[model samples]
Target chain A: MSQKPEKLIDKKGLRLDGRKPEELRSIKIEVGILPNADGSAYIQQGKNKILAGVYGPREMHPKHLARPDRTVLRCRYHMAPFSVQERKSPAPSRRDIELSKVIRESLQPAIFLEYYPRTGIDIFVEILQADGGTRCASITAASLALADAGIPMRDLVVACAAGKVDDTIVLDLMDTEDKKGGADVPVALMPNLNAITLLQMDGILTFEEFEKAVNLALKGCRKIYTMQKEALKAKYESVKEVEE
Target chain B: MPTFFERRQLVTPGDLLAEGTYVTGENTYKENNKIYASRLGLVEYEDKKINVVALRAFYIPKLGDTVIGTIVEVGFSGWTLDISSPYLAILRASEVLSRPFRPQENDLAKVLDVGDLVIAKIMAYDRAHDPRLTVGEPGLGKITRGQVVKMTPTKIPRVIGRKGSMVSMIKQETGCHIILGQNGVILITGKSLKDEQLAMTALRKIECESHTSGLTDRISQMLKKEKAKQKEEIKNESKT
Candidate 1:
């Protein structure tokens, strides 16, 4: 195995992965994959693989934590031990807990929690493989799982990450680029409402670059939103044809 | 200036449904004279009202609906039942058995202990507390025999068919007594093991092919074939 060259982007305006600066990695989504959970979904983004399961809008356990006015939303973001090249721990790490909280908050806006008052909705996202931007992919998968579970929501949330690498703004950075020390910005949005639900930035960027990255991420999110809808439609349409 | 999506059109959250002078229904919200779908589902237009019927979802409790629950805990006066909903169900001792209960002499747990399945009706419900259940009514109470099957709550309507025509057909052909819970629990009682297994298969077929048309005819054909096979087996056994 050879080390990656210092130059992250070629003079031809392409990245090492042969993608343009503004191009995103390929994404694949499937819904209703788990039989046990009320709703479940799987997503593949480039080399990242994630599975999301949703349970409840049913009872809330540890009864003390139950909210009286609206349904409590609990999210768990976990990485399988085999997800990384080096085996990861099965237990929840500090990073995992923080990610879970952010992910849960990102989704709370889209769901109509009040509709299922006093109940709880639990979302579990497992990272089977991690390339880069697993958080964004997990958020996307969790939202789809929630939809599959038939939870009422104001909108579906879509997410994408953008980064500044080699002095150029790129959409959907890969694991290699992410490790090269750059400004990575992950954004989650309610695409139809054009509202940003989650945003996190690491490294540094100029004001102009930040604005451009956000716009690029939003555009990428819209594309993801379209794909999500298509996946759902394909599932339902096939069922319809069989019925017909 | 009312707008509408075509009947049976699939829509996702934030997709516009109708605008102006239209009442929004389930899984829909209105903003600035425009109604939008609040979830992924099929659009419905009826009686000048637009609604989105969700394709899948968890079951929420409703008053007067029948349910199949397992006693999870026995309290002083009531039992906590798991009805497969997010909200637990509470069955008071008074409503559990028809006979008068003397707390000093009769223990509620002895009558209906944990892990026992009971068929009950939702007698009362409120959002803040667990739904109240009653098993004293006829055809309700502990499930002494039969197998339990679960399906999607949304598909229960299909299982029942129009006014229970489909369920009755399954019972007549398989000779199985089936009780369908609105929350998607099903109890099937058959006279023989073979008949019970056949009834379960027929129920599963409905669960799988529920979206298709002519299901009633298809189920009837499947059941008729099974009956013929059973008759042939009986004849061979008698000959021996």
Candidate 2:
């Protein structure tokens, strides 16, 4: 690994990745990638690679846990052994468990679980690679997967991260900036509803800086929301092409 | 009042369809006097109402619709059927047995055992209970032998086409009996295995490319081509 740069923001007022303060990383998202799962999606943002799959609104196993009023939403966030510089254990670690819960909560707001009572919908997210903001990306992909599964949702959820570096706020913090920067904030949003479903902060920032980071992150989220819709439409457009 | 998208336009969840007095129909929600799509589908305008035709969805059993399912459990009073839905369907012994059912004297599994496929009609369905199915109706009973093809339930209407034109064309071309189930289960049966295989292929094609135009013509051509290929194979075998 290269030595940490002394300044995350260079003299040109750009991030280490040569992006402007409010610029997001390159992101590519594909929906319904896994045919076996009811719905699935893959997302790549910068160096991060994540796959999310959704199953059900089907009958719940251990029927006692099934809710009478609405479908139960479950999620699992796992990291691959080769996803990082150090091999991560395949077992669910404390961070993975916590992230799974956060991701599920972040996604729950979008899905209309009441449509299917006495049922459960399961979302599994596998982090093939991790840079930073895996939780945000996972939330983005999981909601898209839920939509692809034909699950009713009030809105699609998208996420992005911003952080403070050298007294300057920047959008879409990468792994190095997150580890070395002053503060990191990840945010997930339902763009149309103007609702923030997930918000997390690490390190420290002043009140004004924090506010600026959140606003920047939200702007990044809104940008990604458009791509999320396009990915869903592209899935069917490709199928239409296959017909011709 | 400006509608964001045209009728039949593809839309994703949270897209504003219209911002006016348009009535919100199925798969849509009204908020702040705006109707937004709640699912990824094609927008539709039905008189004063706006609805979305979902491209893919699970089978939610509706009353009087025919469905095919596999028996998963044989209870004392009823049989549990897996109809590829969030809820399992229930078939009472009274619905199947012509005579009065006596639990001790009669065996339920003997009639419709687990894993047995059956074509039935949805007798009753509500949010409170599992769908109740009855199999005593004419042409609805145990599926003895045939090929089964599964598809997205939302695409079933496409498989049927406009007023049953596509299905009837398939039946005529492949010369097979096709039973279209609302639960996305299809049963194909014919005199020969080749004929059944041809019908299954045609149905699968229809399900995959259901959104495209000229689908009926495509399915007709597909079935006819397969039929011609099967005839040629049979002729070559006789010569050999």
Candidate 3:
């Protein structure tokens, strides 16, 4: 384990990665990468690599769990053993279960589950590499996969993290900033609907700082939302070109 | 009086298709007099109605649709068939048997065992129950021979083309009998394996280029070229 650096912010007031306090890390997204999956997407945000696959609006296994009047969404969030610096166990850890539940809840609001009664949509998100904001990236990728699968969604969900590092709040905390930062707030938003789907905070933040962090995270979400739309359309660019 | 996008324009979830009492259709939802796309698809306008033609999607069963399916389970009085949909379709024993159905005397598996393929019609479908299927039609029964090729359900229209041009062309060119299932399953049978494969390749080309314009003509040209190539190879083999 590396020792925590004494200064997370440089003299120019930039974060350790030379990003402005309100700037986000680079993000790359691709859709329909897995043939077997009904829908799939891969996301690379900074050093974090995540893959999400969507299967269904199909029959639910263990039939009793299916609801009579609405479709059930099942989510699984898992990290590969080598995702972190140390080898994490492949089994579903407590944190993974909690994240899976929260991510599912975050995504539920966007889908029109009532269209497919008694069926199930399974979203599987695997963190092949982790930096700090795996959950947020996973949500972003998983939502794209759902859209790619042609599921009815009111809007696409996008997420980002903001936190206080070296007494200065920053947009999109990296691993070093998250580990040593005073506070971290992860927020997911449906940009079109202007609704916050998920919000989580850890460590300490003053009320004013919390508000700033959330607004900053929402700003980041909105920025990523445009990229999300582009990625979705890029998957269909061939179709569009041929139409023209 | 205003629409946000052009007809057949690519749209993703949350894109505004139109506003002010535009009746929403499939893959679109209305919110406060505004119609928005509910998935990734192309905008389609018919009169005052707005629908999004999804590019990739699951097969939702509808009444009177012909489908190819594999029998997954032989139940007591019916067979559960997978029609490539979220729900399993039920092919009742009574629908298949001409005589008065006596369950005790009948051997259901002997007729349509599990794993056997069939060309069936969706007799009924509703949200309340699984789709009911029937194989009583003359051309819609057990698929004895040939291969089943699957493509995206949304691409099936391209296989048939407009007014049955693409499919009929392939049928005439390859001498292959092709049955297209609404659920994206296709069954091809021909005099020889080579002919069947030609049909499959032509279908695959259609699936890949379904979005392109003038696909019917292009596919016809491709098939003609391949057929000529195959004949030349055969003639050379005879000489050798």
lDDT of 1 by residue, B150-218 (tens): 877777888888898899999999999999999889999999888888888888888766655689998
Angstrom error of the Cα, residue A177, model 1: value is: 1.5
**Docking category of candidate 2:** medium
lDDT of 2 by residue, B1-240 (tens): 668887878899988898888899989999899998998998889887999988888999999999999999999899999999999999999999999999999999899999999999999998879999998789999999989999989888888889999888988888889998999999999888888988888887887677678989888887778778878998999999
C-alpha local distance difference test of each model: 0.88, 0.91, 0.91
lDDT value for candidate 1? 0.88
Give the candidate number with the greatest DockQ: 2
> Which candidate, 1 or 2, has the higher DockQ?
2
Residue pairs clashing in model 3 are none
If scored against the real structure, what TM-score would every candidate get? 0.92, 0.95, 0.96
Residue range A1-244, candidate 3, lDDT tens digits: 4798879998899877789999988999999999999999999999999999999999989999999899999999999999999999999999999999999999999999999998999999999999999999999999999998988899899999999998898999989899988999999999877889999999899999999999999999999999999998887686647656
The runs of at least 3 residues in candidate 2 whose Cα sits more than 4 Å from the true structure, single-residue gaps closed, are A242-244, B235-240
Native-referenced DockQ of model 3: 0.68
The Cα error of candidate 2 at residue A176, in Å, is: 1.7
- Please list the residue runs of candidate 3 whose C-alpha ends up more than 4 Å from where it truly belongs after superposition: A238-244
For model 1, what is the error of residue B144's alpha carbon versus the real structure, in angstroms, after optimal superposition?
1.4
DockQ (model 2, Cα): 0.79
How close to the true structure is residue A143 of candidate 3, measured as C-alpha lDDT?
Answer: 96
